[model samples]
Target: MNFTPLHRALGLPPCPLTDEILSDAVTSGVTETDDLDWKSELPPIKGLSQTDVPKDIAAMANSGGGMIVYGVEEHGKAATGRSDAGEFTEGHERAYRSVAVTAISPPVFGLEVHRLGTECRAVAVVIPASVDGPHLIYKNDFFGAPIRNDADTAWMKERQIEAMYRARFNERRRATEAVDSLFAEAAEGRDTVERAWLIAVAHPRVPGALTRLTRDEAREVFNDARTITLSFSKNTGIHPLDNVEYLNPRPGLRRWVAPNAATGDRSIWKESWVSVHHDGSVSLATAVGGHRMSSDGYWEGWQVEGRGVECAVADFMALIRAAARSLHLDEYDVRVGVEWSGEQPLSILTVDGSGFPYDGVSTPLRAFTSARSTVTASASDADFHRQTRELAEDCVNQGGITYLHVIEPLPEDEN
Candidate 1:
């Protein structure tokens, strides 16, 4: 999807997405709309207590969010004619953030300001539609919530503001539902019942109102065969669908669906599968059946191939990097949950963690769950390697037996 030509056709303006897109908008002959606005200059930041700039931002976000192009002066409503009003200053990004933090009530997230166009003649502020919005411009002795109205800014009516507050919950629910629906649909018609699966889902705290990538572009992205990493325990057997790798699958969707195949065979379960959404959300999953030893010992009790943690840190980093690149995101603030289920329960006490292809363990160890614990860390900070050590705190009394059981039970009240 080449937006460069589309921008030329519609005459858009500077946007936070890219310089080329903004250039096309500038020449598109598009006039100012309720969600679009142009300014002759960046907001002055000489210790000003408050300015209309923050209100301008509130108006756009309150009206479901849009871009504010500073330094380009519109000629009437049509932008058929315009000029560079001013140049970007060094500390302006900080100032823009300040406005959101200090002047706007309830603040906003993902408010980004970028210098755009040739020779830095323009600046664009991209405000993502927020789930926690109806942002008010709060300055000394005044309380105002702004809304955009047909190329103009206006104050929101009391009822409308109240409605915005009430709608917040529904919007959040819809956003969450949308991501869950994506995961459900991505695995459609697949037989994951007998296999173990790792499913990871992420959504930006602020809404991702991004332009969709073209199928051609997505194909180009998935062309890197390494994008879908494949690893299995030496004992794990794989089905012969090696030739099946990637697919576009449908129209108007620039997504990369990995390990491309139509079969539901458990052999392919050892490999990773990815689903990239147009709205910048991503889901990565791998399904495999591995063997879990029970009290029955090394002879085996519960067996499923391609299960258990193997190369977890490396695999996860690769998946996250690939998702981020495909979705065009530079940072991630997401909630992640892992659900691992298989044809049989892992008989932990009998099986040795050392196994065939050693991913990490050097000795035979069996772990049994006695209590549930929540481990928390930033995506930047935690990994299975690091968190495993922290989780060891609960099993210190296992001693030299190479087994895990709760050493300290949490209080009943805490539980």
Candidate 2:
């Protein structure tokens, strides 16, 4: 997540921590900065409660987050060489995590700990810029917020603490508003469409590096989305950006819009379109209903296919993942919704096991005009797939679907 500014300087990514990168840092003599620290030894397990590991972590978290590399020796604050920190086992990882959880107030989440090297092992902890911060360190009767001061850790001053708290609250509010605003924006012209439209929206708690995108960059993101959609193990029904004739910028909203056709028109879902925003929020609006016409040529609305709804939601999750990676974001508040043309309860057509409509089984299994589900989760969580399935199911369940069978199937071992 670009935990350290040195990542850009050294042409390195802040992930997949490797021995080669460590060695290169030593050769380059990279010095400790506001977002990077080096240590020669692991914290002792015996007196772990009294160690500075928690403080270091809190400092980094309070100051835009960074990495703490244990096993790197330093001279005059510059990385000198790698040291033999001995074997790092699961015990070591848990020990460090425990200290972080217990010693810090409002425990920091989403820490990425990596074990590197073999004979002479090392550990790297990647901490995200927390939205819940101004994290306080309370141990042995000392309670105060710690922040990174360039190459040093220091106690946060009263003014700084106040500011951090304000920023934290403001961020929470903005994130909440952003999620709703993005969803409403995606559903802007939904009323005109005769068929049902599926909408997926995601807003990161801590915004990322995507302040804007050039025309080429916007096209590249679409290409990446196409690649990501294809790579998904689950089938996504909607090809969101497939038919866009232009990639246009909406400077007022600080986002780029790629609409399928009728670009100047206010109506959406004439065809599918996607919007990628500067704050790492993204959304997709696509029509999911096919022809349902009568012999008299009167406009008859069709039922939303259950499989297509599930697939579109699944693909939307994939797009969120891609956007998170591109923007270097982690946690997000995501929402999925289904909207129809009229207030009349719209039916959802269930599919059989063979991926076709069931024969002689009452076709419209569930009915609802609209359904929405929201979740706050980390994109990198191990349980992401399960969570996504649950979210998609929850959205449909409101409409009485009960379950989402078309999304990615869970492992047999998982509950």
Candidate 3:
């Protein structure tokens, strides 16, 4: 779990790697262990009996999780060849995930399915060790998925199964405690009763990933804040504060801010707040406390034009996307909520650009949830910007807002 699991499986170092990493591993040496495993070729997701993917995934999850590299040549436990993953189709990730979700009990979360760049076929499947485990293989491969025994996969013993079930309760208790104790400290000196807050909290369905991520890795992610942000129509925001020290209050937790606000204090959610957990979990929050403007660059209309709707949607999307890229995460579940200290806006409006009859209409906050990836995460990734934008458009369009303009400039202050 320490080396991004995917990187370890690929025989690369902890940080993101270049193609050279694979080349190096091929020549130098690559060995497998209980946590590291490999397959010569990715199996067809269908025809359950045709693939051993279930067994390999189950084995890793049952044994505290690890990475399984698919489509590579291996001799003994070592990776001996080139990108075998290239053989897989785009649908492979989805197919394997469908099986993983249903085949394993207490479903695994945060499963990272990524191929290096756009060219390589070598896919890395990172299965996180679950706190709710001994994930039984409930489907086709075996009598349930087997656990890793030495360098091999084996069925879990009765005693091990019993232990996992018992620990499930403790796991739940720890999570509850984490929120109870950390909730207050989450804001700490940064809390202000006068300022309204928008908090985005991400709690991992799979725990313990953070213990594997080093302090250095967290810092590395923080350093990228300068460039990770919202960009639209020649406007860019959310740059990291210069000379900002990395915030590591406790293990598996870190915080940092985006630029110095007028108050010179970037600790609170006024401008932007970025959080990270050792388990590869992260969250972000921003406050709409100060002077603000509307989507079309207006400052006074909080309700009449329904400008805040577009403004809020754009900001939330920007924050989430920035958080994901900074944490080195491909996909994760995030919940975004608004804590209004001031009068809540009547409702968010959905509007297309020029001529939309019902431009100002009642729209729920939930409309923005569908979009996951933003333009900032990776512009090169296929449909990167459209993935999240499309969902937003569909949600609003359903309400008769035919056109959706994504780049809503922050509203100006009334003063």
Work out the TM-score per prediction.
0.60, 0.73, 0.57
lDDT per residue as tens, model 3, 1-415: 1365436556555676445565566555577778877676677667643367667777887787787777667787777777646655657667777777776675655576656535655776778676667676654454654888877888877887888778877876665555434334444544334553444444443433333445565555554432332443112222222223444423433433333233453333225555556544455444433323333332222222222223344444444444455544433343443343234342334434452323355553322232222122323333444544443454445334544454432233113
| lDDT of each residue in 336-413, candidate 2, tens digit only | 777665544566665566665432332343344334443334433336666667767766655446556566566763
**Steric clash pairs (candidate 2):** none
lDDT of each: 0.50, 0.69, 0.50
Q: Compute the lDDT of residue 319 as modeled in candidate 2.
A: 64
Superposed model 2: Cα runs more than 4 Å off = 1-3, 7-31, 44-50, 75-82, 87-105, 112-122, 137-144, 156-162, 190-193, 211-270, 289-302, 341-343, 349-382, 412-415
In terms of TM-score, which candidate is strongest? Answer: 2
Give residue 321's lDDT in candidate 1 (0 to 100): 43
Best model number under lDDT: 2
Distance (Å) between predicted and true CA of 341, model 2?
5.0
Model 2: lDDT to the true structure: 0.69
Model 1 stretches with alpha carbons more than 4 Å out: 1-31, 74-90, 112-114, 117-120, 185-195, 203-216, 223-256, 260-269, 278-281, 288-415
RMSD of each: 9.2, 5.7, 8.7
TM-score of 3: 0.57
Return whichever of 2 and 3 wins on TM-score. 2
Worst 10 residues of 2 by lDDT: 291-300
